[model samples]
Target: MNGSQALSITDRKADEQAMIAAHNCAVARSFHSYFNQYILTDHERGYIVIDEGDYGALPQHLMDRVVDAVPSKMIDEH
Candidate 1:
């Protein structure tokens, strides 16, 4: 669905739930170092920033999934 189109109440809530689930799953699977330094600014706009030392440890696939789960408009492509 396009970003501008308003989601139904149910759809909006479901999306919110999915994002929450995704965030929880990511945290559970991620290393403790990630949590220590990570900050979740928004479910959509912000992303987890791994410290330089831990960056390579994160699985690329998981990162991709998290990015996909986030609202497209909120992602900072730059």
Candidate 2:
């Protein structure tokens, strides 16, 4: 690949790693107990609700990855 393209890939990887670290930190801090629950709902058009009261507005592609990575479920009763 070209130099610019390779650099872009590297930069994207770094950004993704940073985001994952941040998400882990946030999840750990919010859930005090041993078991933590997270929910994903459409907040805006591109954003999603992560662990009630916390929202992350990521790109559509990134949103898909986040959804896949996190354990999410719907509460029909609520």
Candidate 3:
């Protein structure tokens, strides 16, 4: 609603579910999800997708590193 007027990426439980499904689909087939990607939508702002990597290869120690690298969460607050 401000600046670029794009919607926000308010991630959801379904997003997590889709991630699981995609992961399962990938593993059951050929190390790749049948969908290869899933999206998060904000009707006003738009959408975002997740469809990369092999099962989100996250190591225990790297959790903080990855979390730290994500963009700001206050995008829609203003």
Candidate 4:
């Protein structure tokens, strides 16, 4: 989706589902940091952390990384 069509997480669960559909990809939003870290191995993992956080919680750098992320043939061991 474009900037004008960007989503806001007013309702956590619903917004998350919408974001996933907008991206047309698999996404994971969790309160556990470990869950986000673990999904790094999956290419389509749209990891979002909601550990006592809301829409504006994640840093811009992380968001940038998320946007830049693309599927890769090489797997991440970390």
Per-model tally of clashing residue pairs: 0, 0, 3, 0
Runs with alpha carbons beyond 4 Å of true place in candidate 4: 1-10, 25-68, 71-78
**How many residue-pair clashes does candidate 3 contain?**
3
Please give, for residues 1-51, the per-residue lDDT of candidate 4 as tens digits: 766675566656765664555343322333222223211122354343232
1-78 per-residue lDDT for model 2 (tens digits) = 765555478767865665566557546645443222333333342223244324444446545545423433333343
Candidate with the greatest TM-score versus the true structure: 1
Candidate 3, residue 51: Cα displacement in angstroms equals 12
The candidate that achieves the highest lDDT relative to the unseen native structure: 1
Candidate 4 has a TM-score of 0.21
The Cα error of candidate 2 at residue 36, in Å, is: 13
Better-scoring candidate (TM-score), 2 or 4: 2
**lDDT comparing candidate 1 with the true structure:** 0.46
Which ten-residue region of model 1 has the weakest summed lDDT? 68-77
Model 3, residue pairs in steric clash: 7-45, 26-32, 26-33
Clashing pairs in 4: none
Per-residue lDDT for 76 in model 3?
Answer: 30
- Give the C-alpha lDDT of model 3: 0.39
Worst 10 residues of 4 by lDDT: 33-42
> Model 1: per-residue lDDT, tens digit, 1-78?
687899899988876776566566455544433222232334464444333235544456545533432211222345
TM-score of 2: 0.34
Worst 10 residues of 3 by lDDT: 65-74
Model 3 per-residue lDDT tens digits across residues 15-45: 5555555444434443233333333333453
